[model samples]
Target: MLEAANLTKKYKGLTAVDSYSLRVLPGRIHGLIGPNGAGKTTVFNMLTSLVEPTEGRVLFRGEPITGKRPDRIAKLGLARTFQNIRLFKELTVLDNILVAAQIHKQYGFFSAMLGLPSYTREEKALHHNAIRLLEEVGLAGLAHHKARSLSYGNQRKLEIARALALAPKLLLLDEPAAGMNPNESMELMGMIRSIRDRYDLSILVIEHDIPFVMQLCEHIQVLNYGQLIAEGNPEEVRSNPEVIKAYLGRSAEHA
Candidate 1:
């Protein structure tokens, strides 16, 4: 459902993301893994049009969306969550989702000035949809609570809920399990799988947690030094020599 061809991103003398390409098929979870500074986030930025690719193109289905405005890409059914949580801290969980749903309603001066029947109906429907989304992500009890009041894991769930409010065909998630404990991460894995099947979503996930990605994704791509070095199913990627080397090098550094 999504494809990137020969994508590259550079900043002056440093090449952040070098000629990389990948495909995400409908209803499957695709994993992107790499050590720090391997340009994983840069790829996310390029695909979502947050940062213009220095070279190459991104195609949603068959049309080129490279360099399109972020809002335009979002309207075309692409949505993403950041590695670090990016919620409106002061807004209630329900309100955060409602704000996203309201973006889909058709509005004009007449609709606002006269309070047309269609406007009222749309508003009510959005509220219902937002409530449904909150329930789906297991945040119904916290619906009226400030976003900042939720625990870390619930915050991540809320972020996913907000993204799902966009009704995206392809969802890009960056490190959904970044700060979670083992139990939370395992629960997150289940949630991701459930949502993917329930919503018929195509997902491209960039995560550093190896075991989590191995168990949750159908395919994995490994990146190192700003380039894709390996791509395969879990076993193939896990046993690959280069992937082993990358992890081993990092382990040695920590030791």
Candidate 2:
């Protein structure tokens, strides 16, 4: 559903991502893994056009989206979460989701201001969808709580749930398991897989949790020094000599 071809990003004399390329197929999960400073997040930025690529292009469902405005890309059914948890800390958890879910509203400002029937209908729908998403992410009971009041792991889940409010066809998750424990990560894997099947969308996740990515993704890509060193299934990548040397050993604590 998403294809990034020969993506490269350079900041001054340093190359962050060098000729990186990968594809995410419909209804499947893909993983991008690398050690620190390997430019995995750079690839995500280039793909979503948050940072313009120095070279190469990104295609979503066969159409070129390289250099498009991030909001425009999002409107086309692509959504992503950041490596660091980002939330409307002051807003209620339900409001945070409603903010994203309302992006699909069909009514105009004047309609909303005037409280037209169209605005009312769409607003009602958005509210229902927002609550449903909260339930899916196991945050239903905290719907009215401020985002900042949630625990670290719960904040992560809230971010993912907010992304889902976009109704994206493809989701890019950067380190969704960053602060979770083993059992929590395991539960996250199940949630991610279930969401993929339930929503019928593709997912590309960047994570340091080796076991988490290995078991969750059907395909994996490894990067080191801004270049892809290996791309394969879990066992194939786990046994790769270069991948082991460049990243596996460093990430063994998570294994």
RMSD of 1: 2.4
Clashing pairs in 1: none
Q: What is the lDDT of residue 51 in candidate 2?
A: 97
lDDT accuracy of residue 182 in candidate 1: 93
Which stretches of model 2 miss by more than 4 angstroms? 248-255
**Residue 110 of model 1, lDDT score:** 94
82, model 2: CA deviation in Å?
0.7
lDDT of 1 by residue, 84-193 (tens): 99999899999999877765778776997899998888888888998888888899999999999999999999999999988899999999999999999999999889
Steric collisions counted per model: 0, 0
Judging by TM-score against the true structure, name the best candidate. Answer: 2
> How accurate locally is residue 17 in candidate 1, as Cα lDDT from 0 to 100?
90
Q: What's the true lDDT of residue 38 in model 2? A: 89
Task: Report per-prediction Cα RMSD to one decimal.
Answer: 2.4, 2.6
lDDT string, candidate 2, 42-153, tens digits:
9999999999999999999999999899988888999999998889999999999999887778899899999999999999999999999999999999999999999999
lDDT, residue 220, model 1: 98
Candidate 1: residue 51 Cα off by (Å): 0.7
